[model samples]
Target chain A: AQSVTQPDIHITVSEGASLELRCNYSYGATPYLFWYVQSPGQGLQLLLKYFSGDTLVQGIKGFEAEFKRSQSSFNLRKPSVHWSDAAEYFCGGDNQGGKLIFGQGTELSVKP
Target chain B: DVKVTQSSRYLVKRTGEKVFLECVQDMDHENMFWYRQDPGLGLRLIYFSYDVKMKEKGDIPEGYSVSREKKERFSLILESASTNQTSMYLCASSYPDSYQPQHFGDGTRLSIL
Candidate 1:
């Protein structure tokens, strides 16, 4: 079965620090990768997505993700983190059938 | 901006009662989906509708049903609500293309007592 994994359940980082959230997937072939963030009581917002071209895809909210086929990973990163960036992040992929398979989210905490 | 609106932000229902969660999208999206969010489980697709009157079962659709009688609305139905059914239910919509990103609603936090 296709699956997405986020190894870290919770991560804490100092404000202004660089951040990387790891994600790995198990799919038959290259699947469309995506990252979404959910704030305290809000719905999820799409961060970035990797469809085909350029392995490095930039998304809204100063976020970017790199898709590495070799490792089946599409990790989300940011050069500098802000307190407002503290949220639960989820990595997902499309099953090519309009259905999404999502990872067990990673809750990010930023400390000042 | 594409707006996907879920009917309720919070709800409480007793076990064994039927519950309905409504979702509406203004983008005229061809696909609408229902998912449940849990602490350690992230989000699990409950059901999805690709077109008016068309529905499909998702990974965890055993206890849920969906209705898409119109183009802009999709409804998730809990036949017999249970305590285990208490969850943050989210609704999303997207274009028919598989690559299109889904737009999510604020979600309805439902508690089954």
Candidate 2:
């Protein structure tokens, strides 16, 4: 079965610090990868997505993700974290089926 | 912006009662999905509809049914509510392309008593 895995359940980082959230997936083929963030009392928003070429994809809110086919990982990263960036992050994959398979999710805490 | 609206932000229902969760999308997307979010299990797709009067079962659709009588509306139905059915339900819509990303609603947090 196709699956996505976000190893970290919760991560804490000080404001202005760099942030990196890891994600891995298992699938028959390298599917379309995506990163979404859900803030408190708000809906989930698409951060970025990787469809084809250019392993490094930039997204909204100063976020970027790199797709590594060798490791089957699509990790999200930010050079500097902000207080408002604290939220729940999810990694997902679409096998060209219009259905998304999402990871459990990582709750990020930005401390000042 | 693509606006996908869920009828309720929160809901409470009694066991054995029929329950309905309504969703509407203004983007005129060809695909709509209903997913249940659980703390450690992530989001599980219950059902999806691609067109008017067309529906398909998702991974965890055993206890749920869906209706899409119109182009912009999709409804999820629980035949008999149960405590285990309590969850954060999310509604999303997207274009027909498999690679198209979906736009979501603010989710309905339903509690079954």
- Which candidate's lDDT is highest? 1
Give the interface-residue alpha carbon RMSD of model 2.
1.0
Docking verdict class for candidate 1: high
- Locate the minimum summed-lDDT window of 10 residues in model 2 chain A: A36-45
The DockQ figures for the candidates are: 0.82, 0.78
TM-score of chain B of each: 0.98, 0.98
Error of 1 at A22 (Å): 0.5
* CA-lDDT, candidates in order: 0.95, 0.94
TM-score, model 2, chain B versus true chain B: 0.98
lDDT of 1 by residue, A30-53 (tens): 999999999999999999899899
Instruction: Report per-candidate TM-score of chain A alone.
Output: 0.98, 0.98
lDDT (10s digit) by residue, model 2, range A1-112: 8999999999999999999999999999999999999998677899999999999999999999999999999999999999999999999999857999999999999999
Query: Interface Cα RMSD per model, in Å?
Result: 0.8, 1.0
Residue runs of model 2 more than 4 Å from their true location after superposition: none
